[model samples]
Target: MSGRKYVTTVGVEVHVELATRTKMFCSCLNAPQGVAPNLATCPVCLGLPGSLPVINREAVRLGIVAALALNCAVNPRIWFERKNYVYPDLVKGYQISQIAMPLGERGWLAIIGDDGAEKKVAINRVHLEEDTARLAHSGDNSLIDVNRSGAPLMEIVTDAVLRSGREAEEYVRKLRAILVYNGVSRCRIQRGEMRVEANVSIAPEGAKELGVRSEIKNQAGFNHMRSAVEYEVRRQAGALDAGGTLRQETRGWDDVNQRTFVQRSKEDAHDYRYFPEPDLPPLNIDPAWVAAVEAALPTGYEDYVAGLLGQGLTAADVDALSRNDALGFLRLAASAMGDKTVLFAKRLIKDVFALANSTGVPLDESRLGPSAFRDAALLLENGKIAAEGFRTLLDVLYREGGEAERRAGENQLFVETDAGAVAEAISKVFAENPRLIEDFKNGKIAVRNALLGRTMKAVGKRADPRVVSGLLDQALQHQGRADHDRDTRLPRGKS
Candidate 1:
């Protein structure tokens, strides 16, 4: 494998389903999950005779938004093309997609590469298309669910600039984040809202010409996508070393076997028999519309992360907040909390996120809203409630909606700041641990922490830790001075 040097070239094709209320060219419901098979279909989506297609305006607008977000140039005039193919899941023999005039072209997304440098992956086009139905295969039988059919799909193709599997993974990850942030799509890989295909080829190191590329179709996850690309690279390299030839073909990834198997020869553009769709008219994207969409785009993800970091959030917290559903909530709380943003961010990561992970509920869907979160943070900040009390209140707030103060009071979780109570607790702890006091007098000052622990336990978690530490220090110091005076007086007596 090391005799001849080779460089791997990778390009990616990502398809994302738009979160629209209806399908691409019809008014049928777009809900694909949990619906009975063929329940959401209609004449247009099922491709019944005498059915004509009409464009979904909202889907087109979303596609343009995604394209602009990727920094692509939107075409002023674009039309759909019929991509002819045969498959059971494809109700229509020809897929209505774009070829000659895609919605947008020449875009790029920046991804951090293996060398830790920002690398831009060139986007070829962001086109609009319709999704195929779901195919469920049993031992020997197959079933089609048309619920997914006709859902608006966006195809984002990237130039073959990625040199490694890691880079490809990063590219797709960044792309998904951008799309999700822009509200263009949910981009959930597990839900089939997003799919990835990698076209991989290897050429001799420093060769001016590229080698034959093979397409790996529909990798379900990022790990699978990277593995498929890496496996194909090695396979091509091994074949060339053994004086065998590689062919332009399509392959499917076997997650169980951890390898790629041939599916069919790859098809070129002409193979699709592309033609203009007569049912839908050409889409006109005016400059004013493009400008409006561009202006409405959200902050770039990098900028968003940077802003979060600047707000004193740790890098780990920033990453967690950015990737999770709680991001919007965090932002809202941060804005509302003002100078206490870092405190809220920490609590969110340490408490709310941990609960969400354990309970399998997303943060955004939790009963705890931004106002309740801010109130809890304020209580903790003002020392009205200790850390344990705050945590208890947060759990209640997350599970059941209530005011933080009312919940804290109902649970008897207020911090005990009474001076007399703290003093009595310290004296009780000293009485219980006479040996600890004697050791302190003998200069074993490090044992003060043990004494503080005892005092806190005596207070039963109602006392503030800071108050307990202060009271304990005062008692020890007073005992130390008394012992010194008694020792000096006894030494003068020569006893």
Candidate 2:
């Protein structure tokens, strides 16, 4: 028999490639590129003898900004230690990272749940370190690219506050937004700009101690991270049901088959043989320096979302816009288009997000800029364009710009629903369909559908079909001879 319930404990570690112009210790470019491999390395990064390392000031500032944004308390003094692990891509044979003190600690992230509930996830620490290069293994031969060696990296570790797959995904997403907003990282998971690792385990309800945790490393995207955690939850539950022991190990996700395979046993701290690096000096972050970094930081995600809600936006719409780049566009649209700001804001959010997802293009790159969307919203609100015509207008503006609105007008796509004209048209249909009208009077009520068809034909698809059908039914019942009288609102047309 399986356990009554499951408590999934989740923790995440993310590596963000700092937006810096040079490597951590050298002047070489600190960017991933299509240029031939190993061409971007220099003597300092290659760990040649008699070469000293210099700290990159810009990388430290970016890391500080990220820490403050996450609400971490900055450490007064920071230092680096050597994580000794020999590998082909790691030319230095020892990574320079923080051991004794990280830049910040004790921060928290806020997440809104599916039912509009709030959850606060805590941060353990935020530290700065250097990244190793890439390794490509081709069957019998092994290749190494040192281009990324010594690239400045920031490691943000979260406490095990996540309870489920969804919460974990939300945490990562919010973190990505903050990093992008602060201009610290590009926040691209596909391009290896940001990397994620999740630690997952299952326990009995209200258990204080955790189960044996398995670390899933190098998940490529946010979705994959969520999937890995969910899979682990199920797999471990099955094992416990069958009387199997949980092993402490590392696993890799095979995204193609949607299964995780064991990579190796979990490592202990002694395995890395960590020690202070002899080459690099201790980082001393003065009081005034941290204050400056905090001053330039951007607004957090919660504040921005609150501002949007205050602008007459529905909570659901605000939630939708929070995940995408549309927040800025929505803000701009609301400011430019005044009346019915809420309605216009909702439309822009829906269209931009829908188009961006379907076309696989970023919202910022789509032809409809904020100003263009603002124009479309104004036309929609003022009844200058019909619902159907607005769709066509969007297509035209996306493809071609010259005289697009004029062309839409000429095409008659934006037809207004005239209530009087619709009532008149329905009356004419009732006059022509005599048999259906007689059937209705004689209590054969289904014949009312025939009158509806006639009215649809009379309108020629120019008016709203819903309004036309409603009016037609009402005109049929006003005869008063029929048992069930039709609605007068439909016959009188929209007020």
Best by lDDT: 1
What TM-score would each prediction reach against the true structure? 0.77, 0.67
Query: Per-residue lDDT tens digits of candidate 1, residues 308-400?
Result: 788788898877876774555666676543557777788898988888888787775578888889888888888888887788888898888
Q: Which structure among the candidates has the greatest TM-score? A: 1
Q: Name the runs in model 2 displaced over 4 angstroms.
A: 32-34, 113-116, 137-141, 312-495
Per-model lDDT: 0.86, 0.78
lDDT, model 1, position 459: 86
Model 1 lDDT vs. the true structure? 0.86
CA RMSD for every model? 5.3, 9.1
- Candidate 2 lDDT over 316-433, as tens digits, reads 8876765565665665656533455677667766665666677677665556766667677666666666455566666666555435456567666554478798888777876777
Error of 1 at 246 (Å): 1.5
Each prediction's number of clashing residue pairs:
0, 1
